[model samples]
Target: MMNSPVETIFYIIDETATILQEELSCTYLEAVAETGENLFQDDILQDEVSEVTKKRLQKSYEEANIGEQPNETIRKAFQFAILKGMKENVQPNHQMTPDSLGLFISFLVNKFITTEKQLTVLDPAIGTGNLLTTVLNQMANSNVHSIGVEIDEVLIKLAYVGANLQKHQLELFNQDSLEPLFIDPVDLVLSDLPIGYYPNDVRAQDYELQAKEGHSFAHHLFIEQSIKHTKGGGYLFFIVPNGLFESTQSQQLHEYLHKEVHIQGMLQLPTSLFKNEKAGKSILILQKKKEGIKPPKEILLATLPSLMKQSAVEDILAKIDGWIKQNK
Candidate 1:
């Protein structure tokens, strides 16, 4: 038994993840990922358990004392634990997007993703769902819908808990995003595309990317897929590693993007933006091309300093708003 709900939630998640990993004979990351799927039955509630994994998951949830009531604080604790666990226990190569930057990107992207009906947002790599949730909350509209697909099991589960507690509806999937058969095209797409190369399997082959064999980064492949899944004239805002631009293999992708989409904006984020100082980041805002649409004469390009204050971000958003109006 734990003293507080926060402590209990964290302990249960950690212990369960570790136990599952040991039992399944996989990495700790794989175990953490499986924990979420095991807990949730229908993507919303914790009922409908599979017989094999039910005992372990039930014991953890019961120990945590997650009652019928949706405790917002507890849900937040769950999300925090997931983020913390990934940072401390997982390989140093993996990183979660910081909340400050997530909020900044969400608010900045919100201005351009407007719709008469509800705004539909899709995040291809919605680790823990913080970025998507933040974006939705800031939109200040009740009619918005968010869809996220993540490969990380634990992160997706934590994201589901957060959305449920906040009373927000979301479509989340714990599967390989590179697989065929995509969700309906959405009004806007937002994500922190994971960095690194993917095995050139059938899914990679299906993308038919212009890059040579073994050169495809998961981020670039997701960029292509996200563009394909976005409606014509819809917007996509993703954080990508800056090194991608300088790679020779990326030239083919650059050419394809030039032919297919409008480069609305690019922000060179400081290397210090993430915990890993060696990893440089940049924001890419692209608008899918409609049949008769032409690329804008001027694309907004700016560099953000290492330490950006909220006021400075507001100023940037103002400029982006002006650009959107001019282009529209």
Candidate 2:
């Protein structure tokens, strides 16, 4: 049987990356980024690799014909390669958002912003760029400008090469997202918030959501940063901890949200998606406060059924659609 497009492309990515990994003495993810860049440029840019290895890589690239594949095919293929690399050397912060959740977020984004013909989207903690690209792929409008901020060098490189491979024209910044960003207000902000304490106390002090003492929660600072970069009344979608509002600093977060944004919805993700119940998270929809816009008459709250159950998921989505039609 012929290989599926995703399998074929993933095989090419894995094969080329393995060869590069052996040649460069680098980590699997680093080699994967190099492989993706080589594919995007249609040339073996690594001079360190032997002539034999270069020839092998070129053959794989030619056979794969990555440019002819659909954008989602390329994205998924690269995503598989990234997942493989993560398994080889796992970093807690290097995780990519699951495709199912990314797709659902895309649906919410489309429903909320149907009137906008052109939009700018920002992902403050872009990581592998999977979530942002997935959302972009599902959006109805093609005229979108995207910006991704990531602090890790290897992850950002992977994101960059992945964007090139998928032909997504996004601007990426390789720096701490908590620091000042030299970007204009964007139409939408999407992030899977990085959960941890931020080490930079001075920088944390700059954010309204910063903790009162000691190290601040990085996720809280990220929410404030994302909101700051979003235009008034623009939407911010976050994958947050289920207990996001139950922390010691919850009062401050509540105050900040009350002052700056209107809670649009909260959808508790299925516990089955995580390793355990404590690790489960939810999708939070917030719209930045503006002069005329008011809170939804009733927040769109739902506990999502397992994404594996298509009919149940669709039924819940239909209810969500009804809510959107009535409120949006």
Candidate 3:
């Protein structure tokens, strides 16, 4: 029996990446990035690798035909490769948002922005571009302009390669996301926000959510930056910690949200998604303030069932649909 498209693509990626890793004496993830770039360009760009290894890589690439695979299939295969690479060199911020959660967020984005014919979306913490591309693939609007920002060079390189492989024209910036963005305000913003204190106290001072006397929460600053880059009445969806509003600096966050945006909803993700209860997170929905826009009559709130339970997930989605219809 023939291997499925996802498995085939993943095999090609892994095989070529391993060959590159051995030849270049580089890490698995770096080799994966190189492999993805080669796939996208449809040529081996590396001169350092031996001719023997190059011929092996060329042979592997020729065996797999990924040109006809669906975008999601390609994305999923690349995601699996990235997940494997991450395990080999575990970094705290190198996590990819799970596929189920990415799909859930995509649903919300499509439902909320149904009326728009064109859209621009931004992801400030676009690690490897997995979550951003996932949402982009599911967007109702075909005419979308997307931007992604990440500070790490390797991660951004991976994101660039993945976006190219998926045929997404993403405007990716490799810089500290909190630094001033040169782009115009976008229609929507999304992020699986990086948690923990931002080390640069001086840069943190520029944000309204900055702590009065210490390093500010990176997640809090991300929310502020996302809002800043969003057009008035535009929407922002964030995957945030469950205790986002209960932190020691919650008051500042509360005050900031009250003044600049309207809290549209909060849906606690299934506890089963996390390693422990303490690590669980929620999807936070917010809309930037505008002169005519009003808060939803009732903020949509619910704890999602385990995504593995298909029937329970459908029921929750139905309830959400009803809420959206009534509110709209």
Candidate 4:
């Protein structure tokens, strides 16, 4: 219940003990200690650690009231990093970042959504349940069945455990995301993707585009498939680097998106929220609109607040709620 980041981080270590063993393969004492040390060692992790604690203070987040907090976030990062550390197949460079995990949670809560009655949510790379757990937390304890396609069995197990801890009814499969998503009509929660320079099985059925992280590969295609499952006005949220906003190569995708999908909102998130030491990281919030309705002439553009701090998260939720209410 303490406000201090160190204390809050430790608090989550305590809160998730049972599930870590049962689901994510982390024993409380061992994993927590290991992760804290690794976080300190990694220069990228070190750079953001101070802002982490300061941001908690800035947000005035209630350690006790919030069902889950950033501490869980830090732990998930450790778990993912360590798991990657042990595996040669998955690169250590691109574990799902903690702050983006938090932002994913923010986007879900801000929407209060379940935007479509029939469509389900999916995460192809669901490394250790960062996105799924966040989605579970926002469901108001309701069972929203979601599917996670992860090549790592360990992460699939982690997602299973994390979902269970929150009592979220979910299905997790160890599969590659690039292959066709058989679970059609599913909206996606895309987090940190494998960038080109990073290590990943290039031969994996779903992998392509070596220049950028696997983040840009077939994402729009996935969006198109999601439309089959997504009802009109259903929302799709993806975390893409800043380059996507200004890239010349992406003009085709952007044009395709505007030509077909209705624009809901585009948010440029802060850089510190990233897991890796990279130049650009952002959250893209998109809404699936009905076919034939003219898309909004002016896309709603928001410069997202720093996700490291709690106040930033709450402020984002408040504004999004205001937007939905105004439109509704």
Q: Count clashing residue pairs per candidate.
A: 2, 0, 0, 9
lDDT against the true structure, per candidate, is: 0.72, 0.93, 0.92, 0.52
List the candidate 4 regions with Cα displacement exceeding 4 Å: 1-90, 99-119, 187-192, 197-232, 275-278, 292-294, 307-319, 326-328
- What is candidate 1's lDDT per residue for 237-288, written digit by digit as tens? 9998877678766787788798779988788886666658567788898999
**Higher TM-score: candidate 2 or 4?**
2
What are the TM-scores, per candidate, against the unseen true structure? 0.75, 0.98, 0.98, 0.61
C-alpha RMSD of candidate 2: 0.9
Prediction 2 global C-alpha lDDT: 0.93
Candidate RMSDs in Å, in order, are: 5.4, 0.9, 1.0, 11.1
Off by over 4 Å in 3: none
In terms of lDDT, which candidate is strongest? 2
Q: Cα lDDT for residue 259, model 2?
A: 91
The residue-level lDDT of candidate 4 at 167 comes to 46
Q: Positional deviation of 206 in candidate 2, in angstroms?
A: 0.8
Better of 3 and 4 by lDDT: 3
Name every residue pair that clashes in candidate 1. Answer: 33-153, 33-154
Candidate 4 displacement at residue 235 in angstroms: 1.4
Sliding window of 10 residues with minimal summed lDDT for model 2: 136-145
Model 2: per-residue Cα lDDT over 257-280, one tens digit each: 889999999999999889999999
